[model samples]
Target: MSEQWVETTLGEVADWSAGGTPKATNRSFYDGGDVPWAIISDIQNGPLRETAKCITPAGLDAIGGAKKVVPEGAVLVSMYGSVGRSAIARTPMATNQAIARGVVGTQVSPEYLFLWINAHEGQLDQMARGATQRNINKQIITAFPIVLPPAPVQERIVEIIGAVDDHIAALDAEVGALQGVYRAATSLLWGTAEGDEAAPQLLGNVMHLDVVRTPMEAGTTYRLAGVLNAGKGLVDKDEFDGADTEYAAMNILRENQVVMRKLTAWEGPITVVPAGFDGFVASNEFPTFTLADDIAPGWMKHVCRTPRLWAEMQSRVVGTVQRRKRLNPDQLLLVALPVPSRREQEQAAEALDAIEGQVAVIRAEATRLRKARAGLLSGLLDRTIDIESAELEV
Candidate 1:
């Protein structure tokens, strides 16, 4: 520890309190409410600016009235689900019992405390106790160890971290704007209504199920992949030895081939096998298809991600149990897909791909910035890195 730093318990620097939930059964407590009723999910990266739900003044009264209204600038910590997630309240807000609010003393900066708490989320979560939903109580929270430097140092630390945060926020905004553009472009390219230039054709006409199976050989290892629900794309599920396998064979995935999880096809567990996942294996539950020569790989991949296609599959699903429902290969082929000329399809794909490529680059940078922030926070708090030496541009 730095010679100028002081070690103390969190309670010594902040007055701690927990909030309560208003009576849910009482309509007077919530109906037509304006008071922001914060939950664990609302305690995100920065300030508790707004919440998903709200409560009436009667609801405030139910939760101890004026005392329950956490003041703006207070640091809020989630105690239940997503335990230890921390944020500063940008506005006065009421919270459920699962959140702990801390009003910092003159000696401490709320922003500093919020940053420290967020960085130590894993430690606090470890202190939580529960089998199903882990949680920390007032005793554990109040006793959490804190390293406090002088007020000015705290402000400096917060300032350095805040710059990185701002950069990340900007990058996120860029991704969002680019995504909106991509959505508009794809909507035009893949319109539901038939246009004079677009000749709609049955999926069966342009694609066929390719039931290529790879027999598992003993002593060989296989990399397995699974399609993410809602068309997120293929993800590495696991790696297993062929000797331990229960099945005699697994479906082989080829690059640019379309694959879908038969069970959740209605919910869009479909994607084109990207470059890196080529030669990966999946179970029979995931069916594969080969597109015709005229079909653009990028176009088919976008179609897999479209919600309209998913909605169409939903009505075609079969099975008595909702969870067990499946969209069979034959049924999937029966749907009519809007098809344009090869040139138009390729042009649309290229445009959308360009926007997505930009988004991916920005996102990668944001991730790097986040990791750098974590390291900087650790170094600053431990006094290993001098405050004056810090130069976080973003």
Candidate 2:
């Protein structure tokens, strides 16, 4: 650890800058270029490999003063729409104004700073000021207060946490590969593959759906109404504890049941009600179902989510201004399913399940690595541990 504990701003660590979008007026700059242009969309896919758009050399001159490309190792954090999402740059590239470019100092290892920012993710959200479009300008990020530790301790914490990151990344690749397999299998049977017939059938024929109409205790129903950020697979009763019970009068959900939001501000059509919540009552807004024994619930759910089904569902949208799209029970029952042999269905289900399990495990590992990385950053930056000689990863 440095003999003296020092405090500083993020700007002191390195050059903190903002970016600007190149002019859309010029059409020639956007096509066929080696330089990858990254926008807010880049991070949505998880660690980006290549950008969706690229710019030519002329594009750089157009936005001359607006921040330039950061080195491959520098960290970029999304500061608009959603705040505090951080990722390491994999290659030299330009980012849009939605991100704050953080160039770390020699006193701090770049990777260590990334972990620290991640630890302060909640703070990043808290520090943001705008309501309509959340944002943290370069000034806010650069001037943000930060605790510093000796170089050696930063290195050690980084090492320990970085090893976990590598392990998690490996698992992520395997999970992705498995998921690709499942996608291929579905595409083959569903005509989603290239050169296949473009037949989009109704959603009802593939599986069975039953909306729960039962009432819950005390005029209140369960919270597993098949909605939430994580979707309705798992239930957290605490969320339902203080909610109004009058709306809780709905039917109970069962295992292997496919549930969906009949009306929601956000767009989503399907979710699975976990088996544990088998007898739980849902709100009137949710439609619950049971998958036939012959069919794989996983495949059936996939079918319900196909582009074909979504288009058909869109045509069912009614109600002016509010624009509510109701699922026709009869129409849903008539949707055609890709009838594979019972054995193929089981095998496909098992393979898809196995792949999904692997994806879940890798995702869990990624979450843990992120947490460990955060923990180490907090400990090291706060000087919770005295450093004479320490090992950390970057």
Candidate 3:
């Protein structure tokens, strides 16, 4: 520790208080309200400008009046569910009881406290005790240990970390813009008639189910793949021993084949198996399909990501119960989509694929920068590196 630094508890430098939730059954507390009511999900890494839900002045009264509300710039921390998740209120807001609000004193900057809590989130999560819903309390938050540098030094640290954060935010915005461009291109090529010279064809004519069942052998461990909802693509699930399974056989996945979770096909839990996922196993619930020779695998992969196709599949969903509705292979084959010329399909896929490649690269860089930020913050706080003399470029 630096000789000049003072080790102190959070309560010593800030006035902390827990928030409250208004009665849910009462309409007057929430209906047509303007007050920003924050929950655990609203705590982004930076300032929270708005929230998912709102409350009225009556709602404020129901929660115990003005004391429950925290002013703008107040640092808020989650005590339940996502322990240590913190955010600075960009505007005056009231939080639920699961969050603790802190009004910092002159000894510490709000940003400094926010950063400190964020940096120690994992530690806080460990302090939290519970099997199902891990949580902490206002007392734990108030007594949480913090290392405080002098006021100027604290501001310098914030500045150094804030710059990296700004760069990340800018990169994220760039990714968003690129995504918009991708969506615009997708809509132009797939949704419009001008881009597709050929007439639309029923899905059955272009793709057919090819369920390849590989018999499960006892003592053999199998790596499983599951399709993520919202077309996020395939994810590697847990490995399971064949001896533990009741099924005699499992469907094996192949690269370029499309897979869909029959139960949630309406919600877009569909994707094309990528290269690394080939030979992975899935249950029959996730049916695989092979595309016709004329269809470009890349083009079909892009199609699997489209919401319009999902909506069309959704209409075919049938069942007595809403959640139980399933889109079977026979029904999925009936869905129609425009069949662009093979050349056009290849060109469109190449253009969109390039944009996707750029997005992936940007995301990877952003992740690396975040890790660097964490390291820099740790070094500065622990006095391993001096913020004043170090070059701040991230």
Write candidate 3's Cα lDDT for 1-394 as tens digits. 3448889988888766423333445433333546566655665656764544765555555664223345435676655564334333332334322222333322368778778877877777777777667567768777789988788888888888889889999999999999999887885446333644457899899889999999899889998999987777999998899988888899999999989999967998988899999999988898999989988889888888788788998999999898899999999999988888777788788888999999999999999999998999888888887666555353
Q: RMSD in angstroms, all models? A: 4.3, 6.6, 4.3
All models: lDDT? 0.75, 0.56, 0.75
TM-score of 3: 0.88
In model 2, the runs with Cα more than 4 Å from the true position are 1-6, 11-13, 16-49, 55-109, 112-116, 120-143, 146-160, 187-212, 215-221, 227-249, 262-268, 271-273, 283-285, 288-323, 341-344, 383-394
lDDT of 2 by residue, 1-394 (tens): 3265468878887555422224445433334454565655564413345544655556654544343344445566655664444333322234222212333322366666666766676777778877666677778788877666667656766676666667768877777887677667555444322435435443454456676575445534345444542232444454354245655456667777877655632344655665666776666666666766666665654555445545545555444655465655554455444555445555555655676677788788778777765665566566674333325233
TM-score of 2: 0.65
lDDT of 1 by residue, 183-265 (tens): 77776555423444476798898889997899999989999998998777999978888888898999999999989988966
Give the per-residue Cα lDDT of candidate 1 at 247: 89
Off by over 4 Å in 3: 1-3, 18-33, 60-67, 82-107, 191-198, 392-394
Query: Which candidate ranks first by TM-score, i.e. highest?
Result: 3
Q: lDDT, candidate 3, residue 91?
A: 26
Report the Cα lDDT for candidate 3: 0.75
Query: Over the full model, what C-alpha lDDT does candidate 2 score relative to the true structure?
Result: 0.56
